[model samples]
Target chain A: MKDTKRQTWMGLLARADAGRVPELLGQAGPSPDFEWLRAPEIGSVMVQGRTGGTGAPFNLGEMTVTRCTLRLSSGEVGHACLKGRRKGDAEAAAVVDALMQTPAETLMRSKVLGPLAEDAARARHCRAAKAAATKVDFFTMVRGED
Target chain B: MYVAVKGGERAIENAHAWLAEERRGDTDVAELDIQQIREQLSLAVNRVMAEGSLHDPDLAALAIKQARGDLIEAIFLIRAYRTTLPRFGTTKPVETAEMACDRRISATFKDVPGGQVLGPTFDYTHRLLDFKLAAEGEPVTAEQRDADPAPVPHVTEFLNRESLIEEAPRDDTPPPDLTREPLELPAARALRLQALSRADEGFTLSMAYSTQRGYARNHAFVGELRVGTVPVEMEIPELGFAVEIGEITLTECETVNQFKGSRTEPPQFTRGYGLVFGHSERKAISMALVDRALRWEELGEDNSGAPAQDAEFVLYHADNIQASGFLEHIKLPHYVDFQSELELVRKMRREANAQTREAAE
Candidate 1:
């Protein structure tokens, strides 16, 4: 798998709305029989920030994340690490990740990642639009010089 | 000198039970749910997350609910919960430049790349309480415009391009984690920043306010203040590439402070920066001011014996959890210590009386 392409799908899976991945995964088809290489575990990752926004990096804080790894019956490995404490989301995401590498990739991408990506884009647009409404544009030649 | 004191297990248990009942409050009243707190009292949740050094809205909301809306107590709850979770790894430094900004403003420059966005501000609102809100209120709505896909560059970048502001060099050295190690004073910039990031908002605000009143004033202009969500990405060894784990809302303030420059350099502007969890412009601004004040020595400016300029004074007293814990600990039984003090006072009085009587005879 290409790193950037896999990163895109993985990011989409990780940031997917809780339980949305599981529901989307079901619609794709029955998940290939898989065994847990690593069971779902709840943990945290320290978020880092740069010193002057672009300067030396520093530790800011931590946020909760859950992770799981699995292997398909035919032997392809998959891993899912995401934010928050949704075990089901982790399991479903890992399965999708594994399937994405196999011959079933096309079906999974269209049925699962496609809708998630679209919803995410819509949300991004909505937030940006709301923000755009508040932008200030200053008028020139309204002052003493004029 | 510490003695193990006797019983109160039963009373303690009863008191805890009583506290639980009191926390529930008025069975007749509809109890406020976690979701309500998370949504409606969002700023409070944001404050707890900022100071608690944890970023989980649901947990912060639950903490707020359990703490009866006492933000410091809520922060304490979140801090305690944070200790239990195993650490996975640290993330790549989040790029605030890529933030999908909800609010972006600059006091110094009216026209910036992002423009001045006042997103959901209370700045121009009349403070008079609306009577309609006292009763059942209707859902509020606002006008929306198509978002401009134009780039919203950082205002500091403009200063940097002109070489007007002092350079902030890239450093990748592992910064000291205050959670794991004790804070040693004469702390580095990174350590000080980590402490300030989770420092009590009210304390930081007061310290910043002092500087404005001329206690080591660092003539600061709000170069830019932006509120937005930024993606947090981490490298998973298994995947071999960084992935976006989540997005968190942050309020970032960058202040450009006037500098006469140090011995080695000519006159240039200095930078004071603050980034905090959630949409808290007040906290972000205050943090920027205090951050500048603490840079007195590094900036080659005289401290003038101000509290805000003293790193030890500001950092040590800035944590609400540590401050409250030590203060509240006094309420616990100190029978032995008190008894010893009482005995010494009596002995001194007795000696004084005997000495006076003998001298008179």
Candidate 2:
């Protein structure tokens, strides 16, 4: 059976190997500052095991991971990498993942990107609040007189 | 270069030293020897043996000490050791009829052939705790009964002569080991019974109890409950005969349950069997009941959809090791999955609020 996810992830791995992943993925430079950017969407990544020999029970290890980046019209960057057993599938999945982050797509925007950003914000706020509350003042207690 | 933290190794060493000191406890008090735990704390050792599928009391006691008296942890230690031990050969089926009985009871008969020997049971004991045992007591002389060399045949074998109970077919085929293999759906009687035998006693008891409470009620009578030491024999390939290797104490419970007559088949009472390591009558009895309950489908009984009736559910969740491992693993890091869910709910609520404002406007 043709596993689409495995195919997609393998494709990204191939791209990475070719040293043209950034160009094909359309990334100008390595930018970790892009908070709104969605991770690459890979289809089901095929996890292959060590081929002991021919005609042996094929062991699938883990899904190959792939991802992509995209810049939305509102300058909101998004990316997705498709993971699969094959190559071409990964590139397509990543573009689709990035496109889904656009405001124009309601289902994609609501289901995927909006929630991710909101979660990130909530986590940051919660951490900041906790840090503020735990701010300890080094003060010595007054000794009580008999 | 900027340094973050240090002294992890030193801190670990200090913590271990403190733990050792804590284990030792008060200097004045005598330390609990391994032998004392092996003999005096034998019930704990038995539990570890049954669960671990190992029989070494000394090793089990040592494991219990190392685990700080956690019986399950000791069982795990024993199981780890058991897995590493080489399997030289498989043992022949133990002959329980040849068992040197410690305790044998039959609920089916008013008096069985070999007679009911109530050896070391707390059945008729009053709730009052003996004050003598509270303090270090003296060793009392025990009276011995005249030994009977006569063998005790199974009650079901006699019933088989009259064609009253269903004849259990004896097969020489090797049974599946639950510990060695992953459990599959629609398990055979051998596999199901094997799983229940080593299953958690409390869990098995509750499941069996549920059956008695009208859920897949088999109307089971304890045909016989035998606890004794039986000789373990392994076949010598070159000699072409089985040789007695060692002896192991076993608790075997056979339940005679109510039978329904089918159109094609004769009306005969069904049997449920349970066998476990050590003097674990509770586990053995519970295992028998659950085993009988699981056989409803084969016996042409209606599906009750009870927890006991669900083979997949019972077999999968029965092991304390698997149950506790999966149950306690939730305590480990789950921030990644939680973060995903968190984001989804926040956006969903936000969207709902936005829609409500729009409607009000």
lDDT of each: 0.90, 0.62
Q: After superposition, how far is residue A43 of candidate 1 from its true place, in Å?
A: 0.7
Badly placed stretches (over 4 Å) of model 2 are A1-146, B1-23
Q: Pick the candidate with the highest TM-score.
A: 1
CAPRI category for model 1 = medium
- Model 1 lDDT per residue over B95-200, tens place: 9989989889999987677789998788889998999988998898777898864448889888889899987787888888998899998899888888988999
Model 1 chain B poorest ten-residue lDDT run: B142-151
- Candidate 1: residue B144 lDDT (0-100): 84
**True-structure Cα RMSD, model 2:** 29.9
Tell me each candidate's TM-score. Answer: 0.96, 0.66
TM-scores (chain A) of the candidates:
0.93, 0.30
Write candidate 1's Cα lDDT for A99-125 as tens digits: 999999999889999999998898888
